[model samples]
Target: MKHNNKYERPKIVKQVDGLMNKVGRPALNKPFDKIDNVPVDELISNFGSPLFVFSERTIRNRLNDAKNTFTIRYPDTVFAWSYKTNYLDAILSIMHQEGSLAEVVSEMEYEKARRLGVPGNKIIYNGPCKTRASLERALKEGALIQMDHLDEIAEVEEIAKSMDVKPSVSLRINLDAGIYPQWNRFGFNLESGMAIHAVKRIVLGGILKLTGIHCHIGTFILDPLAYKRAVEKIIAFEKELESKFNLKLTVLNMGGGFASSNTLMNQYLPGDQAAPSFAQYADAITAPLLSVQNSYSRKLILETGRAIIDDAGYLIATVIGTKRLVSGYKSIVIDAGLNLLITALWYKLQILPAQTYKGVVEDTVVYGPLCMNIDCMRDAIPLPDLQKGDKVVIKPVGAYCVTQSWQFIKLRPAVVLIGADGSVDLIRRAETLDDIISAEILPERFKS
Candidate 1:
């Protein structure tokens, strides 16, 4: 396969005129009812500024998209919800209802999975560091524990020896997927024969049982071929292990890197253009493994984090003010900042107005409530003329939004789950000073 250097255009530094200005009313007339009923100002007045609003419709739609991809391909495929993506109980409940098992990294997340009622066998315990207690709990419950490093593998072996039962384990593999230049951190190095060494350690250790192999190349992967290449590499590696150790691999775990619908601004066309749909990803990852003529039959498992939840969330904010840049660009300042929705800062975000075009079209920028100098939302976005208070909707933020949010200057935003029947429930409340101070134990001398 030849690499196409054509897509590598330098970042679009210069601004283009508003789509409405270039294309006129038709562009503005694209239905805005999705944004109409839930006005940003109304939400701000009711729930306050910098509110995080999520759509149940988007969640179900994207979930179905991912599930359909695998269901259509293989008879036995399991999707473990990567809890690190967005662990909000409401969101996890949705995935649970959709038949997704939990994939957790930390003791907190493992406990969260148990609390969510995910069966012990359904959970995949992943991460480099694990406390002995967490390991004991997960192993006792019969979870699929994926080992990250050699030290962790040794710890698992020691813990397994202490247990009445042997824990089922899998070794994480790092392969040359051809897309990411940085795949060395998470899994065992495949090229360096470290993965083979780890496999031997697990097999000969006599306490931990090797059940699967796992790898995650990169995140928001736009190219389907990258996954195909990864699948082929993993299959070849799987064959090598089976031949050397005489172990029948029970499952092949491909850690998730599927891209969601949200547009990465660096992308030439929006993320939707380059973003492979769930079905495309399923085909890419499954084809290579299934293609092998006489390989051992193993259950294909997906530990998808972002693709399942990224589109389910919406960050609704009120436009506090609007400013025209000195370079003739437009900006819209909002209540939410990088603290609550950090993905916006990491990826180029798509901005949308709550209501249809009743006002004139203009360029705009969105700002959050943080006082830091680096705080920004979207720079040079094109939107309609606005007043002091107007509703704005920024989307495809379901994954990595709430999970990574920090309680900085302002309290974190309220997360509301809008149900399929239009019923809204507050899954998480906005942070308060009292809530902040609750964790503090003031010294006697400092007490007023």
Candidate 2:
């Protein structure tokens, strides 16, 4: 295919005044127009427009890179896939195949991991809302339960006493790690001495055994030095407890909030340039942990979500229509909306055209098919002229969106996985009208 570098001025320019002010043109350089050797046009043809395509090769490579980077620095390391990020069975299977443990927050997610044949010992349950029944099951099945609050400690004590079994448990501690907007709501506060008190309550009860101490200071943490601070604090706490309580906390779960290559809306530079590499983060965390002695050696656990799978997924949508606003600005609507691609609200998702075009770039407002006014993807993005049927691919959207998408306004679309051998598999089918109404039981008078 021959490239088009020639540019022609657009015909839609109308002077606002006798002396019109010139508008600045934004850059429109795209990295690539195709995905995994498949053109965006052919993907929309084989599947439908507004579809999701995942690269299994990309997922494997990223996970492998993360594991190797950490294991080389810290010998005993484990990575648990954050279930809430993207918990489709197919996605979970890929993570499990790569030897990732399941780290889930809710009861539903914990059950999903179990249903997929994941062993109980391989599951790390983290959250504040695990019911008593869920706690009972987790204890019996040997799942590592990271207690979030003091009330949960009482519930676990009752369950452990009834079963006549001493279950190994961990406490989720929240402390200052030089990170802003601390996540204190999810775990016991270490600064206020609540975490130590909770541990003493459990130890005094003698029904539960303290096995580990875990902390997830914040999310989307960009500074690797922050991890060093967190690790140092956790190790200090470990040593203090060993001296005071004479107990060993074996596992130290420095939870994950690694940033992905999706440019935040507030960011000035592109994410590929701004985000830190895995090796950098590994260095910050492992450097502090390698100083531990042989007897107190703790297994480091990570639950990285977005960084592993964001760049591996793509959302393909076609141009539904185009129009010119009254202000002479160009606007194009696509089939995808906030309902499908929620990342549009936070990150500037990169959209690339399927084919080449020859024209001067203009600032275009991208809208979704929804009737609401907030269904906008990109504002004032520079692009060439687009037709009604032009297909485009939005990229690096593989995290959080899939599991958080709602069945509102429009039905959900299908998700396909592209294998390492170039095979395309439709792992999830699109939703239908019957799916919406199947669970509804209409009253006799309401039934037509």
Candidate 3:
């Protein structure tokens, strides 16, 4: 092995934000080195590094765990795979196999679900923006469309007037759930009576049937008490709707904002230890809901994206180089970055070496290959000493990363799925220049 011992780290003494200026060997001796008993070397040899690998067994098990937790408590729970979370066809297939309905926000996603053979009724269409054509198609296909604004109601009403069938509609409500940076932009506010008024217009219009209610409090909710409080407000709103309009809700979509085992940057404890279990969330949601049962006993709907999938996904990348930072800290560059692992911005992503070595571990900063200084995967974490071409796994990336990933300085890589039978499948092929340039059209005036 070639040693990079060129620059001696400058010695400095400083302290900030409770961190002491200290340089020493890493305290931990062990490194997490495998996935599903498959050695990291085998995965890299077959799929190549800088790859996204998912465990089919993990997905199935998580979905089953969430489903069982809720259904065992309330008995009428339905899990809708949040499309924007990780909508790869194989992932959705796994979700659907575990009996998840498609919960989509836009026309493209709605159409994608339709193409995937998800029945219209099984799809919950929710978002602030829905074109008239999507509303018409959703209506004709018998989808459950949740009204986010009164204008949407009017558009759907207009479409219903021309058609012979009434559109099945629900209302997305916003309320003060005692959470910071409240999400009030998407739905009508319950405190302001906007939500109630929207529902009233739909019920009075006679052109649409108000059949469901929805409220997505926010994302990465660590406290189950926040959900408990949100559920109370939703239940109260449901009663108010029923009492005033005589409209019964057939579906209550408690929009999924469940936290996964990926630790937030601000979090002090590991996610597996700090975040509440599915059982706790189940209890918080279903306990209050079970107390009341009307003729239209609502089908409890959950659209969790991260909790069921994050821990199941892992990104394996090859270390390009290691350097000693000016502060005498170690820095390791990996082949993956914010382009493929955007969650690194707010998540303290767990990264581990592919092979084990015990001594001389140190505090390491993981960086991406991008020329930009901001292309870092982790800030400061204790990692085993690594060399060029060594592999590391950044995990709990099963949700949001792929859906929100964009190519920048480097080409995107392939995504491989490890099946329950330990069979490896290349779900997404690595992007190439041809793939990126397929849509390019040189202007006739500029073409040489």
Each prediction's TM-score against the native?
A: 0.90, 0.93, 0.93
Cα distance off (Å), candidate 3, residue 140:
1.3
Question: By TM-score, highest first, what's the ranking?
Answer: 3, 2, 1
List, residue by residue over 109-212, the lDDT tens digit for candidate 2: 98999999999999999988998888888989999999998889889989988999999999999998888887789788887898878878888888899999
CA lDDT, candidate 1, residue 10: 41
Report lDDT (Cα) of residue 90, candidate 1: 88
lDDT of 3 by residue, 1-448 (tens): 9999898656552222223344333334455566887777888888787889999989999999999998888888899999999989889888987899999999999988998899998998888889988988898888888888888888888988998777667788888888889999987998988887788788788898888888899998888888888888888888888799887778888899889988888987778888889999998888788777652267889999999999999999999899978777789998999999889999999888877764455568899989999998887886766899888888889999999888787888999898888888999998999988899998899977
lDDT winner: 2
Candidate 2's displacement at residue 142, Å, is 0.8
Give the CA lDDT, 0 to 100, for residue 435 in model 2: 95
Tell how far residue 9 is off in model 2, in angstroms.
Answer: 18
Instruction: Kindly list the per-residue Cα lDDT of model 1 for residues 335-446, writing each as its tens digit.
Output: 7788878887767776677665565555567778788867787775667776667766778788898898888887887878777776677888888899988988989998
Off by over 4 Å in 3: 1-29
Worst 10 residues of 1 by lDDT: 11-20
Every candidate's CA RMSD: 8.5, 6.6, 4.6
**How many angstroms is residue 174 displaced in model 1 relative to the true structure, after the best TM-score fit?**
0.8
Q: Relative to the true structure, how large is the alpha-carbon lDDT of every model?
A: 0.78, 0.86, 0.85
Output the lDDT of residue 442, model 2. Answer: 90
